[model samples]
Each structure stands twice: as C-alpha cells, then as structure tokens.
Target: MIDQAKQLREKMLQKSSKKPSRQTRVIAVTSGKGGVGKSNFALNFALSLTEQKKKVLIFDVDLGFANIDVLLGRSPEESIATLLDKDLSIWDIIEEGPKGLQFISGGTGFDEMFRLDETKMNKFFHEMSQLQGSVDYIILDTGAGLSYENMRFILAADDVILVTTPEPTSITDAYSVVKMVQAKDPNVHMALVVNQCTSDNEARATAENFKHVTAKFLNKEIGLLGSIPHDAIVPSAVKRQVPFVLAYPNSQAAHAMKKLAHGYLKLPVPYKLGLKGFLLKILFK
Candidate 1:
C-alpha cells in the first residue's frame, strides 16, 4: 500500500508539471445568480492554481461590481479603464496577491464597456491575447446573468466554469445562463463547481441536476469540476483578505480547492490563440 501511494503521488506530480499546449487555458467563472460566491471562487481558484506553481491571471471582468481586489484585500492602482485609455499595459494593471497570483480589475460599469468602438475593441482583444503566452491560465470572473458582455466572455474562454450553490434559485439561474450560452454557441465547453454545499452528496446532486437539465433542454454536456463545502473558515479568511487556500491551507475548503486544481491538471491544454491572440498582446501591453 505504501509503494502504491508513492507511485500515485509521483504520477500526480508528473501530470501537474506537464505544460499545457495552449497559450493559456482561458476560463470564465460565472454563476446562475449573484451571491453564490462566484467572485470568491474566482479569486481562490486562481490562487489555488498558483499554489500548484502554475502561472495564473485573474481578469475581474465583472465590470461595475469588480471585487477581486477587495477579495485579496488590496486597492487597485489601475484598472481595465486604464487599458481602455491606452494608458497602461495589462501588466501595468496586474496586482500581485498571495501565492504570487496576478489579478486585473474590471472597469466600473457597462457604459464604458459599451462605449468601446471598433478601434478600442480591436485594441482590447489584442492586449488580451498577448497575456496568453505569459500565463498558464486566465480566469475571468464574469458578472451574473446572461447579458451581452457576459456571453461575449463566456464564448471566448477555452472553458467556462459555472458556479452555483444547492439553492433552487441558483440552480435555475445557472440553468438559464447555460441555456443562453448554448443558444449563442452550442459547442461551448462548460464545467460546474458546487459551492457552499453541506455534503458531497448534496454537491453531486446539484451537479447531476444541472447536467440533466442542460442535456435534456440544450443537448449540451456540462462537466463537474468539484465542490467546496460550507465552512466558516472561508469567510474568516475573507475577513483577513487572505485566500483561504493560503490563509488556512489545511482547511477543508482549501483542500477541496486543491482537488479542483488537480482536476484542472487533467484537462487538455488549449493551444490555439485565435484572432484575439495578436490583438490582446498589443493592446494589453
């Protein structure tokens, strides 16, 4: 048994070290509804990836409600707004957090996002693509619901991780978002993260429920990433502006996030840069 455990550990470590073939695995963290801990999940998820020694960037694309900075207990010196004005590179706005994770704040509102004309839109994509080569993963914390901005980022990501609690409303909202995204692009790859569940069984049930509804109505497959149990340690860590994964590495929630990071390790690296590749580098830099 000891030898087997050693071999398993070695295998896991080997898998984690294998670099993703893609420039970056762009993942959009979205929820069916607000208050499901979507932003917190996004922050901690990125931090967890960093703990695994993977280079990660958190794009706080929540627009007006961006709080990734707050989650990390830092005030932003710059934001997506600076990028829009061509005043700073994406690197300029990136703030280092616990575990050496980097994060960029989303702008303050939809009006600025909507105001992006063809020139600025082109510039924005260019800068976004540039970061692809420098990071292993880019996690976008999108605002709740199925707005045009949310759909845009969801479709652009290499994968989408939908977060929801066991609440009926959260499930419904998650289902609705999935339906909307599918309607726009049927082939979108999506996964689920069940947060605030009391038990693993409850988390699995929530994931199963989402899978069934999505398959029945949208004929889409939704992957189950993992779950985080309801733990006071999470909020307690939040109060300190430290990621639970780092603030309390031995905590249950931290362990679950580590498991989720391991699960992410098994996924195939996304290699294609697409049209946004060159554009993102230029504008963001």
Candidate 2:
C-alpha cells in the first residue's frame, strides 16, 4: 500500500507539471489607509487596460467595505460567496463592467477571510486557477492596512501598486504599510501611484518624498508608476455610476490615467488594441 501511494503521488505530480502555465500580470492595488481612492484607482486602471484590449479581471478583495461593484454601477447576480457555496464557478461570478472588463465582487457581509481552513484555501486556489488562459491581468483591490488576508494576497501578486494621496496622514500610513510588507518580503516589486494631487509638480514631489524616505530608512527602491490629478469630473462620474476614463475621456484625470497606464504597463503612447494584438501574436504562442 505504501508503494502504491507513492506511485499515485508521482503520477499526480507529473500531471500537474504538464498543465500549461498561464502568463497573468497580477497587480494588487493597496493603500495604507481608507478613503484614498484605492478602489477608484483599481477600477480605472482595469478599464484603461481593457481599452488596450487586454483581458482584465478585477477582484474586489476588500472584505470589510467592498465597493468595486458600486463603482462599476453593477449588482452581480453572484459573488465570491456564491462561488464558495459551490453554486457558481469563478466565471459565473464575473460581472462585465465598462469597456468590457470583468470583475468579481467581494463578500457582502463583514466576515474575516483569515478564518478559511485548508480545504477552503484549496477550493479558492482552484477557482483562481480557472482564470488561467482566460485573463491577461488580475487586479486585486485589497482593503487598506496590513491585515493577514491583505498581506497574503499582496505577497502572492506579481507586483504591488501602493496608492497614496498628498495628505500627511495618507503619506505616513502609506509608508508604514510598505515598511511592513518589506519586512516580510524583501524582494517584492513595488510601484507607487500618487492620487489627488493638485498639479504635476505636486504629484512628483509627493512621489519623491516617498522614494526618499524608503531609500533612507528601509534601503529599498520604490518605483513611481504615475499620478492622477484631483479632478472634479472623477467624483461627478462616480455619482453617475460611470468610470471617468469612459465618461469623460477628454478630462484631465482621464488623460493622466491613460498616460499612467502606458507608463506602468510599458505600452506605447496612444495605447491601442494593436499593441495587445501584436504581443499576443509574438508571445502567446
């Protein structure tokens, strides 16, 4: 019986090895504190990527205060809880958002995710694995702070996008979050996105201040991805349940988000579907 069990394990390992791996650009959008427009950034960033014709999946992992669905003006028929109940698959829970983007809403109740057991963990991983080959990017909209569940998702992602505003409290909290994460994972790739800045110079200064502090204290390098200016059009669009990028493409915030998308994702200016088409043809075979 021991020999038979060993043989079965070997076969399982071989089968798993043969399963093709999908190239997914997983990005976690996290902030040090709440009310810094983290969800807004996540929603707009996914939309910007979808405009480039990339298949993006935005996962609303903000357990306590889930708002991605509200931001998209969507009421999903199913959610992560539905999937956990085995009544729906990952694909079944995905709701189509603006610009053809897909999203998975977080659980509606205020249940702590850290209570998940090994069996539930396995099930969740299997559900996420189903996203393989179907999505080009998976944006994890994590809750603010360094909760155990939040850090777990942040560490699992390929990159972490730290969101912050010009407020003193926001900046300080942002630094604290980064410091905590670095203590756990020294080589984690981090990118900074400054939001609610008054002007280009203000954004640059805020990012520089963060870079300076991190380098001096933690001896770590934080890449400044880009910034979004404080534009009234964003809140106005939100009130109407529309993403600013789609609602007011000519707005300053919209244009800045597009530029930030191009810079962060390393896509060419005037980002178009042609870039993704070219990449898929050359790299996805």
Candidate 3:
C-alpha cells in the first residue's frame, strides 16, 4: 500500500507543473481541550469535502495522540518521523485512507520535529513546498489546548475551526485558545463548531453566546461553521474503526456533516498563503 501511494504521488507531482496552480486552503481544526471530538470531526469533514469532488489531505499533527490511522483501522508504515529519520521525501510518507482521503500520521517521537537542526529544517521546508497546489485543502488535526505546538499550527493556518461542546469548562477553554491566538496574531481567521449538542436550540444558543462573548470582550467575531448533534451512531462508528459519515450516512450526525460541508463551500474564502507560506509561518513563528 505504501509503495502504491508513493507511485501515485509521483504521478500527481509530474502533472502538477503542466496545470495552472491555485492556492491550497490550509485549515487547522482544533479545540480548547480534548474529549470534544475534534479529530473525529476533522476526519469526517475531510471525507465530506471529498464527496464534493474536491481533493483533500488531513495531516495528523496532534503530536501526543495522533490517531487518524487507528481511526481508519490501518497503520501507516511511514510518517513525518520517517522523513526525519530516513532518506525519504514528504511524498513518501503520505498515506491514503478511506474514500481516497490522504493523510500523514504523526508517529511516535513527533516532538522532535520542532527541534530539527538547520540542515533538516531546510530539507523539511523544501519538501513541503512541493505541496503548494497539489490539493484543494489540507486539514490539520492538531492537538487540543494552548500548547506551543498547537498554537503554531493554529497561527499558520488560513482558518481555524474551533471545536467545543456546550459544557462551561469547554467554553472557557475554547475562549482561551482564541485569546492566546489573538495575542500572537490578531489577523488569524476563525470559526466555531459546537459538537455533541442535545438539540438545535442548544447548539444555536451555545454558538450565539460564545460569539457574543468574543465580540464583547475580545473584540473578535468568530463565524459559526455548524454543529453536530449527540448521536449514538458516532460512538458506534468509532468502535467499528469507520468514519461515521460512511458507516451511518443516514444518521443525524452524518446528515449534519454533509450540510456543514455544503455551507462551508458557499462561504467566502479568506485569502490563502498556500503550503510554502504555511511552512514558513510554522517554522519561524
């Protein structure tokens, strides 16, 4: 599987130069804390984009708990760690998941990625630059909270999808993420996703209150992306190691994801800086 993926990547790269290039949207999907179903949402969201005939890649940069491969029931033989430890390029490490979604696993020892030497740093940036126009979107599944690593991912992205629940602590922590990011880069664009809601009214109220507070206190306006209802099918799909959108397409959560994807496409996109720009910000800032 790994060899086949690498070959496919080569073909794509070969044809890329012949085609007019467009900026690939880099979206970092994160949360203020864990247990809010952030990674699950990122996976399903990418799959939903693919359903719209857009090519997408999900990079698992969660450092501590990267599990995109586990969620797909397949183990990647190579990962970002491989690019550092071995003589492999970035394309050699990308693995394909279900529904033709591509992803890069954050293997164990991924923390070392932030401490690269000068030579490795250049090589890493140069390899990643090749992905500038290779896909329509690159969704980063970053770790939750306000860690330094997570902040780097958030600041470098074109937009952020902040995932949170209706719980008070979750709301508070989510605000912290926004506050910290604003402190560093006030120009960063962000949106909200209220997951695990019990009803539509609860979701609307949660999103409204959160947006209102950000506007009043932080003086920032966070867009409302969409919400996912608390459905048993999500957990069941997780247990089966299948994306809920595929395993239970008719379920409430699946229907919500499809709607979310459609709404996201219709929204006006903020200016993007592409993969090379993303690498520069992440490595320097």
Candidate 4:
C-alpha cells in the first residue's frame, strides 16, 4: 500500500513540479479544553471559508473524538489510519463535506500510528507534500489542551487559532496553552477566537481580557480573530448533522461565522510555510 501510494504520488508530483505552486497556509484550530465547541467551530469555519470561494481542507486531528465526519452525518470507511495501514493515497482518505469542504478523519489508534517505523512516517510526509499547492488552507482540527499530539500540530502550523469561551476555566486553560506554545517556540503565531458569546460586548470583553493577560504575563500579543455568538440554531444544526453556516445561513451564529471567515482572510499571514515546510517541522522538529 505504501509503495503504490508513493509511486502514484511521485508521478503526480512530477507532473505538478513544473507548474507554479500555490502557497497553502496550514492553520491549527484548537482550544484550551474540550466542550468549548472547538470541533464545531473548526468545521463551520472551514465551511465558511468555502462560502468565500476559497479551497479549504479541514483535517480532524482530534484522535479521541474524530467527529468531523460524524458532524456531517458521514461515516467514513477510511481515515488517516487507513492510509497508514492500507493501500491508498492521501487523496483517498480525504472526504468532501458540506459546502465542498474537504476533510480527512483522524482514525483510531491515534497514538500507535506514529510509533510505526520511520520509513512509513517518511512516506506519510511525502504523500502529504502533494497538497502543498493543491489547496488554499489546511485547517487541522486538533485536540484541545496541551497534549503531545496537539502540540506537535500547533507548533508546526503557520498559525493557530485558539478557540475559547467566556468561562473562567476556559480562559485559564487557553492561557496555559499560550504559555506552553510560547515557551517552546516564541515565534509560533497564535490568534484567539472566543466562541459561544451571549453578546458582542461580552465577546469583546472576553477576547480583550485574554489578550491583556497574555501580553502582561507572557509578553505575547495574541490576535483577536473575532467571536461567535451563542445562538440556539447552532445546536439545532448540529443535531441535524449540518454545519450551521449551511443549515441556517441567516442565523446570528451563521452571520458571525461569515464575518469570522472574512476577518480571517483579511488577517496578515506572516508565517506561511506551505505543506512541505509544515510536514518537515512536524516530522523533524
């Protein structure tokens, strides 16, 4: 399976080598803790990006709860583990969700998959390199908190959007993530997204307070990537297995998501290293 995927990838790479490469931004969307609506935010955010006519792929790296497929009411037969264990190309594992958003599920055995031999690891990286210029953004929906797997993706990404809420515990944990990331790599660019806000004032206050604390303690200025209001339509859409941005486009949360997408696109991308650079950092750093 590995050899065949490699041969096919090489052929495709050869054909694409001569063409101008499109720079892909790899952004990791994570949170301080679970239940902050991190995964949901990641999914809808990707869909919102697609609404703006941008090509986006959201990879669910939350090994324990790989619900990107489930959220779309999709039951994928293959996942990242499938590509690692079976005969398939990286493209084979990528599944298209609502609004033409492409995603790859984080299969079971999330920990053991990386313990495999180095050759398979290299092949995986080589396979992923094909996506360097193939998409506009690769959003990695990583697991919350400072787990080893989550940190690897966070550190390697060109930028990370840390999702949090107005709760005190959520803010504390989010700050912890910032401190850990800053300690490891101060150059790692990170932004904050306060989700499930009751009002614009509350959202601004939450984000501003977070920004203030990080700057004062860690001397790190986290960018505010806007906030999402607490709308009932979000859970209803979730129950229906549809992204709110698609199911209820006129809802307050949906409108906020659209604005978030536009704001994200306008933000300065100062650390775009493309897919290959991202893989190198993840695999070797």
lDDT of 4 by residue, 114-177 (tens): 5667977877887788787667789998888988888989988998999999999999999999
* Best first by lDDT, ranked: 3, 4, 1, 2
Cα-based lDDT for every prediction: 0.77, 0.76, 0.88, 0.85
Worst 10 residues of 1 by lDDT: 276-285
Q: What is the TM-score of each predicted model, taking all chains together?
A: 0.85, 0.84, 0.96, 0.92
lDDT of 2 by residue, 1-285 (tens): 335434533543353355544356677899998999999899998999888767788989898888888887888767777677654555566676766587888776424334555666556556656565566688889999978767776766667899999888999999988899889877667889999999989989999999999999988888689999999998998898888898999999999999998777683223122222222321222
True lDDT of residue 20, candidate 3: 48
Model 2 TM-score? 0.84
Q: Choose 1 or 3, whichever is better by lDDT.
A: 3
Cα miss at 203, model 3 (Å)?
0.7
Model 3 is weakest, by summed lDDT over 10 consecutive residues, at 11-20
| Per-residue C-alpha lDDT of model 3 across residues 1-285, encoded as one tens digit per residue | 557767867766765555546578899999998989998899999999999977788999999899888788888888877787888877788877787788888788887868888788888888777777777889999999999899989998998999999999999999999999888988899999999999989999999999999999888899789999999999899999999999999999999999999999999978667677789888865
Write the number of the candidate with greater TM-score, choosing between 2 and 3.
3
> Among these predicted structures, which one has the highest TM-score?
3
Provide the RMSD of all predictions against the true structure, rounded to 1 decimal: 8.9, 10.2, 1.5, 3.3
- Candidate 3 deviant stretches above 4 angstroms: 1-6, 14-19
Off by over 4 Å in 1: 1-22, 109-111, 269-285
With candidate 3 superimposed using the best TM-score fit, by how many Å does residue 160's alpha carbon deviate from the native? 0.4
Index of the highest-lDDT prediction: 3
True lDDT of residue 159, candidate 2: 76
